[model samples]
Target: MRILLTGSAGFVGSHLVERFLGEGHEVVGVDNYLSGQRRNTELFLRHPRFRFVEADVSAGLPVEGTFDAVLHFASPASPPHYQQHPVETLLVGAQGTQHALELARRDGATFMLASTSEVYGDPLVHPQPEDYWGHVNPAGLRSCYDEAKRYAEALTMAYHRHHGVDTRIIRIFNTYGPRMRADDGRVVTNFVNQALRGEPLTVYGEGLQTRSFQYVDDLVEGIIRLLGVSYHGPVNLGNPDEYTILDFAEIIRDLIDPRLGIVYEPMPADDPRQRRPDITLARELLGWEPRVPLREGLERTVASFREVGEGRPERVGVDA
Candidate 1:
């Protein structure tokens, strides 16, 4: 099948392109490289089954021809990227998503939205399930990303219900792995880079806040599986294994250098105190659950960072 995938140069998007191509599908990739890396697309530039276009999906998708599937993965996913380009982030989630859905509607294609766990802002629920209404601050600093995704999910459902479009929404949790930008300001990258540089790993507000980390491979697999199923509601795709910020920092320190120091700072406003996905729905519907352990995933991530010498940085910041 031929597929049209936006954000093809992004960390997760690039991985999806590789997976789709490996499964013998033709993919037309699109990205404006806002937060995505050109090196990622370069990996598949020469592939016979892959084609790329440089365009921002928020404005419009400058592409022709029909596709079997339309994967709308475009957006500034990281905190720094979204915070830096707030308007663009919001536009991508609103206008960009509509454009992708329109294309899917036009060609009678299966549409899949790449939503995030941020929609469950500072969630009151311990383990976020598909039914939770979420506890988000609509006017907060992080609202740009959180609300954007919430709006995207709503639009996805509208397209599905009103137009009879086949749609899938995957609420991606904190994912980390190869191709993650070193300066993206995510916890895993921040800690990994800090440890590699022999610098003090920065932990915010006593480092008691917790987050569930999911490996990219596990996420990509769940995404592919979702496409094959008929479930159109939002599905949680993440690791249920939880860890506090301090404990996670120690794991990174142990992996890179046991002697690395850990420093505490004020936590960001509106940051979620806890994040753990209840994947019972995912298990029952898609027969999917994360398989990679945090340590092993971090080990592989560290190896990837080392290969590219990507640990040197001024200071560490996290999306959470």
Candidate 2:
């Protein structure tokens, strides 16, 4: 299948491009390099089955082709990146999603919107399921990303309902692996980098905030399976394992150096106290569940960061 994937140069997008290409699919990737690093796509530039286009999907998609699938993975995903460019994040989720949906509609292709666990902002419900409506602040520091994704999900459903376009919505949780930006401002990367650099690992609040981390490969697998299925769903694609921020920090600290210490800081406003996806629908429908263990995943990620010498302290300040 010929697939048009936006945000193809991002950490997850780059990995997804490789997966599709490896499966003998023709993939045309679009990215503006806003938060996505060009280095991530360096290896794929020579692949015959992969074509890269440097353009922002929010303004418009410049590529002209009939694709079998239009995967909308654009937008700044991390809190620091999205908060730094709030308007761009909103525009990409709203306008960029519309453009991708239009392309899929035109070509009769499967449409996939990469939504987020942030849509379940500070979730009151434990182990968020597909049915959870979420507890998001419409006007808050994180609202740009949270509400943008909420609106995008609504738009995707509208298209599916009105235009009869085939649509899939996957609410991605905390994902980490190689290719993640060293300064992406996510918990995994931040702790890994800090530990590697022998700096104090930063923990926000009392460090009781919880999150579920999924490997990128598992997420990509779930995505591929959902695309082939007939169900137009908002499935939760993430590992069920849960960990507190402090526990997670200790794990990373032990992995790198047990001597590394943690420093507490004020938690960011509207930060989710807990986040764990109830992937019952994914397991029942797609027969998908995460395979990588946290220890193994973290070891692999640390090796990748080491290869690129990415453990240095970030030059820019970011909220925790």
Model 1: lowest-lDDT 10 consecutive positions: 311-320
Quality of model 2 by C-alpha lDDT: 0.89
Look at candidate 1 and give me any clashing residue pairs. Answer: none
* Per-candidate clashes, comma-separated: 0, 0
True-vs-predicted CA distance for residue 232, candidate 2, Å: 0.6
* Model 1 root-mean-square deviation: 3.1
Clashes of 2: 0
Shift of residue 292 alpha carbon in model 2, Å: 0.4
lDDT of each: 0.90, 0.89
Looking at model 2, residue 207 earns an lDDT score of 89
Error of 2 at 147 (Å): 1.5
Error of 2 at 219 (Å): 0.7
Give all TM-scores, in the order shown: 0.93, 0.93
